[model samples]
Target: MLKDLAIIDYEFRQILLAVTIDIEHFAKIQLLDKLEQRGEDGYSIVSSFLESNDRCNKDGSVSNYVKTEIDRGKSGCYTNDLVARYPSYDYPVWEFMELIPFGTFNQFVQFVAGKYSDKKLRNSFYRLQSVKSLRNACGHNNCILDDMKSGRPSYQVSYDVKNALRAAGFSETTLKTKMSNERLQQISTALYLHHSSASDGVVAAKGDQLRYIVKRMYRNIEYYEKNDVVKSSFSFFKQVIDAWYFNDD
Candidate 1:
């Protein structure tokens, strides 16, 4: 369980980094510049919102966590020397993306993606929210699989994700039933995001890691055979991994 959680945390970070970098290249304008254009007061409003304690601050800010990350970078705390290249608060979008926390980065991605008209990019933002939740759970050493019962999710599963699972041979009834469980919803969304957005190499590498996880999970399959919740959850994820990553056809 620990190993699986760890892999989800690691792979989500990698995927976030890769996707953020790609967005930097794809947007053509700097993220900060784009962000400033959204408000009359510009950086002040953005900074204050970022620093605010209010939960309704939807614009998100790079002022809190990001500033600390920038300070760490300037102090030679990070192994990546690229961070040290920018010696001031005026970081490029790529540098800023790299330094922010997972939650902040997820916010930035949503903020950035909203600027474009692409439906898929916006949907990916929603998917990342689930991944962020899973990542936080793992980071805090929480038991990710403790709950397998349905009707507890704070939000509905993404339509795109449901479609993908259906295409992978899961019936609509199965998705509607199983995805209602919060843990399954999150874990499956993380898997979907990893498959859809991660780089091919990242996907391949994580695929290898997931395969190992599956093998280890089934090593004592008999132990869980009668535990329908555990058995069904594990089998659902295993099928997803096999269909999305290991399938050649």
Candidate 2:
């Protein structure tokens, strides 16, 4: 599981950094940019990509021009392919929201888009499907992704992350830079621990599983700030996880 996680953490970061730095300017994206810009602690890059338009350039690169010759060989992202697969005609991002698991892909986008998409979020949804899978691998203490896991990521997993990043128009440098941050590593481990604990170490559950993860986030904050729990920050079952703990607020 750890191996799966290593691959996923690197990959998810790839998607986030790609969206924030390289993607074209759009209203939805701007708010997400601000989160990263202001908080200095939030994962807003991923947030922005989730909210904004997902169209690619005719050249299939986010930057108006390709800077490296190697970039010419990149494949079309699953986002475009998903748009191509379902809702056959040209459309926007919201059309396929229902098809996406968990519905948060669309909900999060709508939260930022301020309007629903005219197309579908399936492409983004597929990428997230990869995120959850990778998340499980790491949470279980199994393999490591870039660290060279026992089971290497399938082409599907690799392409999902890569394509999501590409769809957001990010460069390899930007993706790698953000992904290597110690802060993100800490965040990923903590989230993994919390999510895994939520299901009593069962990471196999699907989308409904987010509530446990979200619930744990609030609990972490509460235990840290309110309780002043001066432990090693290592409580696997730190507290009860409840979505209402966050959503009701």
Off by over 4 Å in 2: 1-89, 95-231, 240-249
If scored against the real structure, what TM-score would every candidate get? 0.69, 0.22
lDDT of 1 by residue, 1-249 (tens): 446534543554454344334333333234445555644233343344344423433567333555555566555656247666655444445445566656666666565565455465567667767776766676656666656766767899999888889989998777888989887887777777667655677678767767766776676667765678777876887898898889343
lDDT of 2: 0.34
Model 2 lDDT per residue over 1-249, tens place: 334334444543443232221111231244345334445233343334343435467888553111121122234364445544533222233333322333244345444333333132434334334444444443444433233212222323334343444444556654354334333332333333333323422333322344443333344343345332222121211221221112332
Q: Tell me model 1's lDDT, rounded to 2 decimals.
A: 0.63
lDDT of all predictions, in order shown? 0.63, 0.34
The 10 consecutive residues of candidate 1 with the worst lDDT sum are 20-29
Provide the lDDT at 202 for model 1.
66
